[model samples]
Target: MPGTRTNPLRRLLVGRVQGVLNNRASGETPVVRSAHALYPPDSVIWRVHGDVTTMMIGGVTALLLQMLHPAALAGVWDHSTFRSDMLGRLRRTARFIAVTTYGERAAAEAAIEKVRSVHLGVNGVLPDGTPYAASDPKLLAWVHVCEVIGFLDAWIRYGERGMSLADQDTYVAQAGLVATALGCDPVPQTRAEAEALVAAFRPALTANARTREVARMVLTQPAPSLGFAPVQRMLMHAAVDLMPPWAKDLHGLHPSAIEVPVVRAGTMAIAQSLQWAFAGRATPRD
Candidate 1:
């Protein structure tokens, strides 16, 4: 058997995975094994954000959850290319996570600042005449919490089977460092608090035409290439299966009882295959 680096099997698996996650040209690549990264290599965030498959599923879940909030949805609706190029939107977000989680301190901080700057311009009136801004502290907090929780939830479901509450809290705290820098106040320090915050935000999260339309695009968007479509479908189903019951219902999405197990099992098989491909590579590409 060839080494992981030169193995055709490894390259093929890793290539296909990257082709989907790195779907668009973002002009930035994640710095692998940087000794000067913001988080240590052994940190919980690195582990949670490192798995490409679960991160994809979690990311979809996060987007769906985030869009339920009118402000978050408004920001994307008014400023983002989500309607025309959903894959580009996904790539930009995935790149941001990759850089912040795996990039060096300067790069991570730069990514944060870029996003903050962009948020300053992303304000608009909601469909109900409510004013909304992406830079609002509470709204930012909502997005942050949804993302971190979604990622952690996916990791527990597919990547790591038995992560403890304490570790999960650690993951939230570690991930919150970026949120704090971005000026999001009241970031949650624990999974319980995060869940509480989600419930608290419920009064503000609404399901409407815009929300349902975005959800449809998220669920039905085409993958970058035909061969990757199956992987994309599997990830979308798993993400839906991973969503909280309330959020799923808000989006008027139904769970396929029969496909749930199949989706999970298929994702597990894909994840394990990628794990094997990157088994001994010094820097596993997520």
Candidate 2:
């Protein structure tokens, strides 16, 4: 049943989501769905990336964590288009992840190479006059580790509470395939390693006006339209709720105890809806 053809509801939901990833008109192909992908379909990376709802929450948490580093913040403050078209920037990011995670291996490699080429032009001096480059392997590792922990934690919390430690490490290592291709040095191949790496970078992290402004825009950017406002708000809350306590402290986000359960339940509702919409469509082994 899991590999059966999609129904109308499935198509409808997917169409809306794909609309953001590709500028192609609805019903036009947005991303490739090769039976031959970068990873075998059974891989943990596929399961985590396939789930739309949790990935949205995880992505926000990753961005929030990433902005804490002044070097990371400097790159965004200098090069990002978030100030004018936040949604477009987010969609492009999502597209990159989707393409790398699910598209054919050649397509995935092309996407990674495109990013590498772009990084070539991204070097600049920070406010403190320290030179920074997106191509720096250490900086690439920071970005990769943040994303690995973010997606893994979000999947465990919202998608599979009973996921095993072995699987968690597997997820980290599986994601490292892409990281290595992108030239991220010291990519963590296990959850424990990922945790340790984040701690190692913590001393270098800080928050100032630039950090707050980026966080505010990331958290409060308007929905694609009014119809999506409530969904966006819940995702923002769930992301904050799932974010590590230390990160929340850095971002000055303190969710009340009363809001925690409410956010969890609402997010679960969204996750379930997504699960249903994707039912019988594809398998991890597809």
Candidate 3:
């Protein structure tokens, strides 16, 4: 009889991959015994957000779109250290989403309070010397809407399954709660409302030197490691593909006709790979 034995290199590789995929070193653990959760277990938001691939791509899309708003971009330019620590910024954002969506009610509220405190300290003069405050409801609304819309768009385009009309609306409404918590007003309660809000606000968005530079940074930022480059590039292109035409044009981020199919295929492949890798890991919150 052959002895049952596992290759040492195979075991080492499996451990390394698991560590990367499930590491909580930065304190982003989902609370298994929280008294309350932001959304219910069976909610559509949980389903859409649970996928790491779509959420990561959606986050890039959100940041790109959010920069189109001068005030929002100005706020970041004046205060954020994104240039020096892009990965840190991404980790922070991912942590916020994780704790808020999956952590207990108390933890989520604490995270919101911490963010509000940070916003109170983030104020500066724009390039035109127009004063800007992160606490402004209007600016907050713009950021919130861009992020929510991006997440929904990515999930819809690249999700494992199609979300129904009602579920889409539910996702928007559910997400609106987080926006409201962050001091955003006129939070869209449905898909139609969200779309209308985006249309109404388009005139206020623009591309400028700063916006273009930031867009470039988002696309060309160095990956955390060499092995991560190809995946990062794929995610960036996927983000561009998911972006609206006007927004993409604003950033001069046109994917060539030949590149479009490649982007779509790569995005789907990445999304599917992530789904397979993380299966049964993130249990839907109850």
Candidate 4:
């Protein structure tokens, strides 16, 4: 009886996994058509972004980091429906990154234009009556730097171990193209420059009531499916662990020292499972 059930259960699991991996790509018009890929097969951006587990987890970390900026938080607060539509927010971001990094030049430019059109309508007043605009070059730069750095940091910590310094810089520079397209100015092309940009923005970053609420939502949101709940918890823990110490302090998160190793081990286990599940699958450029 156990043998009889094993194959069916395995098929069900694999089907669910395939659906997730195919998100936004299984459409009649895929966001990243293979022939139109901008990044070559061996490009650093492709390698860094191909890991689904790390990228999604890194996205959560990036969201928290980006919200630290008052203007950025105001944009989301006034314009985004993320409180009720977190998955939509995540999917749009994932699609943008996926398309820009792998889609043909024309398609990528189209995606950027779509985002810019949306940004044009997102300007509003903050709680203190200070004005904020999603398209503001300064705010765009903050969001872009936080996101790319978060991705690179996640890849380095969990996905790849021995990337050369040059390759790291290449990934940053390559990611900057999308940022520049979205109207962020002075995109950093090197690790040092990116780090300096982050440092410069630190003085303007703080955790406020809204930031804490968003962090709570990200960490505690129910998994989309019951089967993925355990994996999601592990991933969230890993994301929190990957955050800067100052960020942790800002959010009032004190992940127990003892829990760090446990979270890392669990996250790695999940990431490896994904790698195996996706074995022989197409890379981003493919």
Q: Which candidate's TM-score is highest?
A: 1
**lDDT per residue, candidate 3, 132-209, as tens digits?**
899998888888878788889898888845678898899889998988999988889998988888888899888988
Query: In model 4, where is the ten-residue run with the lowest total lDDT?
Result: 277-286
Q: Candidate 1: lDDT over CA atoms?
A: 0.85
lDDT of 4 by residue, 23-141 (tens): 54445244443556767767888888888788978898898889888889888877888889776677678778878877787888888999999989999887778888888888898
Residues 193-272, candidate 1: write the lDDT tens digits: 89998999998878899889989998999877887888889889999999989888898887778888898999999888
Instruction: Give candidate 4 misplaced runs (Cα > 4 Å).
Output: 1-14, 17-33, 283-286
Better of 1 and 3 by TM-score: 1
Candidate 2 achieves a global lDDT of 0.83
- lDDT on C-alpha atoms for all candidate structures: 0.85, 0.83, 0.78, 0.80
For each candidate, what TM-score against the reference? 0.95, 0.92, 0.89, 0.90
Better of 3 and 4 by lDDT: 4
Q: Comparing candidate 2 with candidate 4, which one achieves the higher TM-score?
A: 2
Task: Between candidates 1 and 2, name the one with more favorable lDDT.
Answer: 1
| lDDT by residue (tens digit), candidate 2, 179-230 | 9999999999999999999999999988888798899999999777565678
In terms of lDDT, the poorest run of 10 residues in model 2 is 277-286
Q: What would the TM-score be for candidate 4 when compared with the true structure?
A: 0.90
- Better structure of 2 and 4 per lDDT: 2
Q: By lDDT, who's the top model here?
A: 1
- Give the clashing residue pairs of candidate 1, or none: none
